[model samples]
Target: MHLLRPLPQYLVSRYHGWVATSYAENSAWYRRLADDGQRPRAMVISCCDSRVHVTSIFGADSGEFFIHRNIANLVPPYAPDGLQHGTSAAVEYAVTALKVAHLIVVGHTSCGGVAGCHAMCSGQAPELEEKSSFVGRWMDILRPGYERVKDLPADQQVAALEREAVLVSIENLMGFPFVKAAVEGEQLSLHGLVHDIRAGTLEQAEDGGRRWTRV
Candidate 1:
């Protein structure tokens, strides 16, 4: 908390400027949104990395997408424990309450989470048990993906691993009964997208022989 004081003031000032402009440009809509409720068409699961912003990437308005961000943008398989699960809860709310029509999992290149997973798998980083850190635990979700494509060339391996993680999250989405029902009923569509930050392009995972291609 002590480390964030300086930045918080700057951010608050910037946000005030944005708020002033937003009220001026869309005062009526803003008032209605504040009084009424949000009805987003899609829900996007994205990384919490400062560089990856779903709203900016999609050019969406405030209530366009119900967004959930986490380390590496992971979605664990549905579980009904007493523990609070942020990503799963968001998914539930988006699909059940908001009734969003689409759920998009966005994975970006050069993700620290992915790199950490790679490092752990390669024994470059300390073992999970030894570290006992949040990142280490969070990255456990991507272990299967890391193992699946560990044999490829360094560059290709990272891309494959990242894509694999995206697919895994999509599979995890299916673990939720509501998500499954929505998709099966043709009310919801699930998409896995990979964003090449350096290239400033998006790649949609495809079926058959073809793989990630620019969108």
Candidate 2:
């Protein structure tokens, strides 16, 4: 806490403004949510990109979607090593506790994390391969995805990997015992999507992942 810096006064004021206006207008719903607890129907795993607003894109309100974010929105295969796993923990809670019916992985264009992984896998980013590189190790989950796209040109490879990231997450999500069970029982459905930043378009992958169609 000592190392933390105070947030800007402008942002603090803006938050207070929203609390007084939007929060006040929706006070009843807010109180109901707080009292009854959240039972979101869907879980969205997305990148920690400021540009990609999951709720805004989905027209979702509070208590509608359980959202978890991480670099490149990648999900690692279930290891269950009795170690701390933030993403996996979120997925477990969403599926078991929240009982979310849909689990969606959202990838995006112009993703810095994906680009970095592409660079690292292509041997263009030696720094990320260092033993002390936490990000590098975290991104190792996507190495299999990189292998699928490694043969393409640099530009195409980045895009391919970006799309592949979504597929990889879907594949990894099945690695979770609970997720796999829910999915097999038809209680949970898995989805993959990509957001085009410049075009402001959203695309959903076909059932077979053969193509992406605008949604």
Candidate 3:
């Protein structure tokens, strides 16, 4: 296609380096994964931030987790209106097809997506309010979360909203009929976590997102 171009040289070099080292050492493992197909134990819904590395944080190897990344790591309430739903599709496949035991919604500190939602909600960013802005529309999923933390101090609102994003996503995920059934049947478990990027710490929500504990 005219719109597609060759990969950048840096990325090409990185790919070759990986193939020579990591991939070379794990060739047999890769072959086994390819032959048997992926059997990930958990599905992580994480932010698109480059700083957030789920595998590195968990010390997981390839094929160990089925990961999906999106702005703010937000999942919308179940709405099967016959429209394309990338996040929903990933969740469906992860739960029904892969049968992942855990579905984790991971949020991070100082997330740009969360900031954008904060700005949009506070009427500070008019550009994001446009209907044509994909990032803005996707971030609308976190509006309810923003409402909960809006009353906090100005300096603390963004950070609070970041954790709220994870909680909101976990709540929306259960709105899916299959997800509810899976939980009720004891086939799946849900987790909400927020990562402190600078501190390299993680906190998990307990008691249905009402309390947080270090994990």
lDDT of 3 at 73: 91
Q: Which pairs of residues clash in candidate 2, taking residues 3 or more apart in a chain or in different chains?
A: none
Ranking by TM-score: 2, 3, 1
For model 2, what is the alpha-carbon lDDT of residue 61?
A: 95
What are the per-residue Cα lDDT tens digits for candidate 2 across 179-212? 9999999999999999999999999989657899
- The global C-alpha lDDT for each of the candidates, from Candidate 1 onward, is 0.86, 0.95, 0.95
Model 2 lDDT, residue 54, Cα: 95
Tens-place lDDT digits, model 1, residues 1-215: 55554567789898889878976888888778788999899999999889997798889987889999998889998888988898999999999999999999999999988888888887888865365687888888888888888888877887787787788898889999999999999999998998888888898878821477778
Q: Candidate 1 has which clashing residue pairs, if any?
A: none
Which candidate wins on TM-score?
A: 2
- Which of the predicted structures, 1 or 3, would earn the higher TM-score when compared with the native? 3
Tell me the tens digit of each residue's lDDT in model 3 across 1-215: 58999999999999999999999999999999999999999999999999999999999999999999999899999999999999999999999999999999999998999999999999999999999999899989999988899999999999899989998898898899999999999999999999999999999999988889999
